[model samples]
Target: MGAATAAALVLSGCSSPYDGAASTDGRSPGAPGTAAPSRPAVTPTATAHPPNDAVGRQMSWMLGQMNTDPVSSDVSSRFTEQFQAEVPPAQWLVMLGQLRAQAPWVLESVTSDGKAGSASVVAQGRRYSLTMTVDDAGRIDGALLKEGAQGETATTWPQVEQRAQLAAPQVSILAATVGDDGSLEVVHRSGEQGVRPIASMFKLYVLAAVAEQVRDGALSWDQQLRLTAQDKTLPSGTLQERPDGTAVTVREAADLMIRISDNTATDLLMRAVGEDTVRAAAARAGATHPEGITPFLTPRQMFWLGYGDAPQALDARAKWAAADAQTRAQLLEQVPMPGPGPENIDMTSTPWRSGVGWFATPQEVVQAHLYLDTLAGDAALAPLREILTKNGGIAVPDWSEQAFKGGSDSGVIALSFLAPPPQGTQRRQALVMIGTGERPVDEETFVAATADAARLLSEHR
Candidate 1:
């Protein structure tokens, strides 16, 4: 409704962002960046003096993406294979194009600490914030451009609750004070007990299930898993388009699943670990409402239920919705899933509103984040941290430990964050918000809640 959040947010896939706490000179109904669009293509802009460090190099690369600079190998070389796959070439093009077209963006200055940097740019005729981060290997983790002032004030808790409430017709938020020992004390709760459809945020539980196998010796991260016809679900990821029989390591699938919300990778991992483990994952993570989340549906099943034109698809969905958990699980195997191509799936409708997909309360998801974070502390399960942090959804300044996952369907959007307070902030924080209605999810509320969450965690509230 204001700036170009609908366009700017799309650049950072809905899954996560390594940086950018989120700023919008405008507001709109759709969840900016979370519900993904098919990768689009475009060119980049040029900057004379991008910084002189890792983050600076990324600035040059990203600036190149916005400007019409001659294409270079910097894309593949500057980013990890995982990063490249996560964002895809088309997304880079379109997202950069959106950032470019949002307004006349001029790089005013850049600040980098060798690992991470912030580039202050003037966009929409106003000075805005754009940040870039890189790993130890100097690979691009993420870049974010948003409307932020240099010394912006922290948002208050009531403001945070109000922002969270604007998400949808039924909005639920769970905010807690996170302890250094991975403990979460309830700080505030607004409809936190209500179960709402979580969309792809369900992948967190799926990740936990896989981690259990890896930890128990039943699975190995590097162990190879082959793609098959059954695994092809849909996007929010790129793996579905890969030819059948393509082999991928379990770790690769997990990375893709969490980082990009790769539906196909999620299905693969879910299959690898089985529904039982995921159910167990919910319980272990302290899910108080088991019936609300059980009978997990793969992305393919989800797609087929909402978009499938097959004769039985509609009826199956109705029966699936009415049946008990055990029967619904049986129906999943007995039913044939035949959904339309990606182009035909209607994105503006709320198919999941009828309770066709994974559902969880904000409180449960918050606990799940703590549970997953606890698992991440284990030496053998160390990879879990990398998987979760692959795409720190909202980019908060100086946050060293950001594990993010956000999901959205037509009318549903859910974002979960669990990270120790950023540098100079001692309070650990965890937040999960779920919004649902009859249209696309709202982005403005998320922006406010995210800003407030950062402030809440930074200070002793």
Candidate 2:
């Protein structure tokens, strides 16, 4: 319910949104696709491709094939039969047409790790990020297309804001140069300082609370914690499936919580640090809405609040609305919330916009990252850096010392990053905070837009 998929941090490329956040290889593409029956059938042989511009040529070739009827060779000549089986040539063209993607696709560049690769391409005025799987014979296997980067010889801050709004009707984006003293010098921003739902990104505060505990000697990273049935929340992580008594270290839980958006791990930390502790951490991180996060709703409460017991005698919707912060705390402790089971859950609903999650301003999120950045670099808080750097979300490896925490629910998505600014900028860090909601943010389009934003921040000097 927090993040939709496992978020794998691809060192030099983008991982599939389906990949788990902690896994290094979960983003690997499946075996090459098979040919559609209409095409001239030929076996796709594996060919070794060294890290070179050859990947760009192959991407260009594949893009060139999209304009044809029945996709010359029905794309059988270019892709494996297995790959073609799911998406035939006609459907491919139709999907591209929906995006209004123009033809004569030009390959901007490709990053290959020998086995998998990410290609950036431009056509007309639109940019695309493609995760292409090339078999050993250099045959195409599987591909995931990310849409939304604007087509421009160069991107400007204004256009970045324009593209951000396209991703969500309600959007907030603010980029800043972080000072060593923890102040933010605003560089670019589009939205007001309004508090907005931040979905699982709230886990960052929970993480901060955990780090605070470690620093105060109340908690230790290597300290063992056990997961009970009551502690389990829902997925966007695998921890929910473990046995009730499963034991994990504080560091291990924090890793899963950040890397995979582990709801269970988040709740465990909240338990360890207490909601009051997290509230203090949130205040320190510059949260805009103190009331919204004071109790720090867990995924279980979020899911329950999201799917309120409308028809039942214990209507959480009405009672929760009338309750004060103190009463809300009581409700959390006394109210019967949903468990990990699938029954009675309505994930299809849009509870995020109703503010059932973390609340922060785009600027405040930058503050949050700044605070985290400081902790990450500290000797006592070293685990914080490793946890955050584990998944740098929308990959743009050019950004030095990239650390990220992004969150999403049905109708909300937040992407925040902290890293050193471009050379000669003389800034401690380049911070990006974006939040979009009111409807489900398109993962592909939003991801592309984010990548473009990071790429443009390089010119911040």
Residue 67 in candidate 1, Cα distance off native in Å: 18
What's the TM-score of each model vs. the native? 0.68, 0.71
lDDT of 2 at 136: 73
lDDT tens digits, residue span 1-461, model 1? 22455334433332233111121111122233334222122222334467678788778767765556655534677776766777787656555555556644567777789888887665544445577778888987765565433222337666665655555666776778777766668776776467788777787888888888888999998999998888887645678788889999999999988777777888888888887888888789877777767677777778777656555666666776677888767756665664313346555666775667888778778778888888877788999998888775665665556788877667666777877765665777787766667765445445556556665654545
lDDT of 2 by residue, 76-119 (tens): 66666766666676755555453333454555656776557776
- Runs in model 2 deviating more than 4 A are 1-130, 134-154, 308-314, 318-323, 330-335, 341-348
lDDT of 2 at 321: 49
Cand. 1 TM to true fold: 0.68
**Deviating ranges (above 4 Å) for candidate 1:** 1-154, 179-183, 330-335, 339-343, 421-427
Q: Number of the top candidate by TM-score?
A: 2
Q: Give candidate 1's whole-model lDDT.
A: 0.67
**Per-prediction count of colliding residue pairs?**
19, 18
